[model samples]
Target chain A: MPELRQEPITKNWVIIATERSKRPSDFSVKKEKRKGGTCPFCKGNEGKTPPEIMAYREKGTKPDTPGWWVRVVPNLFPALAKTGAGETHEQNFYLTKPGAGAHEVLIESPEHDASLETHSQQHVREIFHAWRDRYQALINEEPIQYIQIFKNEGSIAGASLEHPHSQLIATPLIPPVVDEELKGAQEHYQEHGNCIYCEMIKHELGVGRRIVAKNDHFLAFCPFASRFPFETWIIPQQHQAGFDSINDQQLHSLSIIVQEVTQKIRGSLNQPPYNMVLHSAPKGHSHAADYHWHLEILPRLTIVAGFEWGTGIIINPTPPESAAEYLREVNTNLVEEKERLSWQQVH
Target chain B: MPELRQEPITKNWVIIATERSKRPSDFSVKKEKRKGGTCPFCKGNEGKTPPEIMAYREKGTKPDTPGWWVRVVPNLFPALAKTGAGETHEQNFYLTKPGAGAHEVLIESPEHDASLETHSQQHVREIFHAWRDRYQALINEEPIQYIQIFKNEGSIAGASLEHPHSQLIATPLIPPVVDEELKGAQEHYQEHGNCIYCEMIKHELGVGRRIVAKNDHFLAFCPFASRFPFETWIIPQQHQAGFDSINDQQLHSLSIIVQEVTQKIRGSLNQPPYNMVLHSAPKGHSHAADYHWHLEILPRLTIVAGFEWGTGIIINPTPPESAAEYLREVNTNLVEEKERLSWQQVH
Candidate 1:
């Protein structure tokens, strides 16, 4: 029998059906590795992809040319397309729009071999600038309410191609997961009249148990109720809701912190597959003072199974305190080591 | 830079961070297998486990003895413990309660190798009785608002032990995901004055594209917007909110359908790992005319990469229609084949 369990505060019901139970040993991870050969994102194969939506080229280099450091293109098979006018139609109990949205890919490097942690601080800064530019451009488009920018590292993390790239998809809707965060933040603000993220940062800075890395403007730490092992978030110290509003100096500092954290993660976890997401306020919303923008990093250390899917309560194996301690002690010198290696390869 | 994008209808935000991007080829699947050892859940190992909270025994067999066909014991390292009073405390912007709840293991069979699909119908029925029994017991306890019943099949699905068992974790707070579903269903009911699930059933029955199995009491189909590949839901045909209210006649039919679906899935996907959750109306909620009970089956065919984690929008490779069709065509003769093999082994 499947029992209907309600969460007291949230008042959500999750059905736990034990009659259809399974053994733990039966879940096998898919280990298939699709080696890259006929790659579309390769440098010389620029003509194979959709016309460059955006590209950072060296001065004197033509568009879609080999001399580009990074290139952005419309996805060949976008989940949400840009063709249709954004309109939602409801049919009885279900609601769906014509999946009208923009899906673009950001080519991180021409080499396709170097990971972000291995990239020079300058290169990382360029990537940051590209992101800001794209975010601004996509949000200004008609009918786009939100823009999602994310990178899937390693196939286990869900990358289809072997090339180093990230994707941006503009959507007509705000997903349910994001709504929870917004509501939580809004409630926190309503009670305290302050940004929840700012409060979290202030507390983390004071407590110092979950802190991973910090600079003058940004602070990174494992969340108190981290949903996964080694899950970390990087939040701006100031009450900012939009990532595009980041100034050049803050972007530079963010680039440094991002590089350092990624390097430490790579060093500590032996380059484990992971995911990084940037959370900013929605476009068209008057500055949501209650919300502060941040980046959340979830390492693909464990797969979410029955309990999490059924109950929405995650069981993280590594406690946040231990994860923070491990990350804090990571040797920052490895960033220089990785940079040296990349430079040698480039030369 | 990764941008946080929000879903409009659900009002949820996801972070898309490309600065910490990884190469596509690097996202290879990791097939980590658990090392087998002396089994703790095996028969005659009663001393190694906590005292049995519940069990089904033969007439003269003792509580912690070898004669029991099934057993229930407290999880040693529970995510939510039973000891705490679960006092809620607020620290500035954060709110948390002690991780207090019931975590118990439902040992499926005395024989370690028996899968549910291979279990006798009587055994499956017994499991249902046990589920209902435990759920009622937990709900009676104060501050325990929800009870989550789930089974993690295989190591990649976060199963630490290589045993044939399921788990039940009762919690104080309602999970956010469940809350979204309840709100969505409730809102639909308010607008249409009908159960959203019943409407879905009507639509699915009308359009047989996603139907996997159907019976007099239940209907199983792949959701139109499935979050994972080969994901299916077994929903009641009638407007029933609580699963515990299921009659014996319904249980017999449900067991057959559940067993058949499991067999078909096993045959179709080469015994792929899956998670099954029963979604029902919360405890104490009198038969909600607007809600319907159901079971969700998520097959771990693909890893949820960064895009899904960030956006909450799943990109399914195989369409639901194709998956349902494939599952429908599977041969159920495997049941007889297994029986014959077992008979031969006995001879």
Candidate 2:
């Protein structure tokens, strides 16, 4: 029989469709070919993009130049502009707000095709540092209430370009999903006198069924109520409420775990499209003690249809235990060599 | 500049990404080929499916016979099974329940290629009748708390079979999205002493820019804060809480309006993949007077990526007003003939 499992924090129910349970090999996604063009994010092509806001470059190199490994640029066609007054207006029952926010892109590498799974541990750490720098800068903006950091890989996961990059959007209002998390955590804190996520981490560690990986600072695991196949989360083992609070040592550990989990996912699923999101407390949030920050990796393996859209109830065909088992068995080094050969043959 | 519009009832903010504004013609999807095999929902192949639950057929025809115009059958691989305790189980802090509920497929037409936009008005009415009958039957079940009626057209929208069909899933608990709508509506009612949907209808009619099509009993319009590009809603003019309460005359008008709006969308967007969902009051709910039943049509033109997943804030490239304008200009009769000619050339 299938099971309806409730997400501990959000209170959303997900139906684990065991009747049509899918193994890792059952989901096959074709690799998207890069579009033929001059890559704007390539090292020498930095002039093609807007002026850089920040970059981790050689000491002698100038901004928007060739020496940067990770560069931050404003989105040319931003969903929200930075020039608005950020005022909310009411028209009878309806409400409108000026789309006043910052939308910046963090080019993760100078190489056109370098992914987090393929990058060196130090390179990934530099990316995290750049992300932290940008997050701190955006949080200081007067009107910004929330900053969202996320990465979309491959075309179907909403990567318009094949170049590896992540985005940070600072908004005037806290998004609804984050708000729900905050509210749920606050409620749990009020009732139980502890963070719900901290309790969840303890449960997962005790059960030992959903853990994909763990280090001194971070633990990676598939959530109990996984909404997607191989939906993994990397969270701080300690009670940390913000991504900006990470120390250099913690960042190194996070990078290692993130890369390990991503490599396993790519190895097992044939380089499927995925989205990685950093969920942190809202700016100046009151429930910082109750909330726990985490990074969610959602593999875009299934099409979200009418049922999911209408009801917010996902039908995940793969159980988290099965997903974690597959991940545990994957040899990332061997898979990396196999992937290189396959790519060469395809090209 | 982009604009942030808040959905009236749910209070979800949607960014109208005017910077990347897309017109109706900007989105194009290739038509999918039918797999070379028997279609189970076709008139002669009713036996291929699980036994019929209910169907509109000729009086003399047997239950799983060829005479049926519309058929309802159990989903072969149901997300939720009919036999289970449906008892909530607590494992420490986590909660789970048996997926004990009904999942049924409502075959809209016996003809393999028929669609809501292409079907005759009378045929559409019969489909509505079958949906209503199944919904009423499922609502009376002891464990059922909500019945969701939805249709997914084309492969990308999650249609596995080529045959036109809708699905009804009666679940033991009310879904979260429905719960949010209920709570929002109840809050609005408590504050204003009127239904939020009724107020929305008045606002749209008064503005006159968002209306797509309307009749004496029904109105079809793009919502102010549509999450999707060509998202549209069809609602009754008068307040109606439960979809089961719709009368014959109201059903007839709804059929006309639904068909017209769907035809317009098909004509304007060249038959895009879409999902249509019917939202109604939950079973034995107290806020019946505040809730209003409606159908939402979401065109699947864009990929939902990291930002949307993380934030629950949708970035819609096409504004609802622009979508309404394009829909209003479409000549459905002429487009229908053009479609037929194109189909002949291809097939």
Highest-scoring model, TM-score: 2
Please report how far candidate 1 places residue A261 from its true position, in Å: 0.9
lDDT string for model 1 (A73-137, tens) is 98886766776676666544355565666889988888767668888888888888899999998
lDDT of each: 0.70, 0.87
| Model 2 docking tier (incorrect/acceptable/medium/high) | medium
Candidate 1 — which residues are off by over 4 angstroms? A1-38, A334-347, B1-37, B334-347
TM-score of each: 0.85, 0.95
Worst 10 residues of 1 chain B by lDDT: B338-347
- Candidate with maximal DockQ: 2
Cα lDDT tens digits, model 1, B1-347, are: 22333322233433322333323222234454544357778888877898999999898888888998888999876667676665666644345566667789998887777777788978877777677788778875867877778777666666777677888988776665556667777887898888777887888887777788776687878776665566788887888877767888788767767777888875556576778787766666537776677788887766777667665766555556666776766667634333211212211
Q: Which stretches of candidate 2 lie over 4 Å from their true place?
A: A334-347, B334-347
lDDT of 2 by residue, A86-154 (tens): 889996668999999999999999898789998997999999999999998889696899999999998
Q: Residue A245 lDDT in model 1?
A: 88
- Please give, for residues B110-184, the per-residue lDDT of candidate 2 as tens digits: 888788888888888999999899988988796889999999998788888879999998888999999999999
Per-prediction DockQ comes to 0.25, 0.77
Clashing residue pair totals per candidate (backbone < 3 A): 36, 0
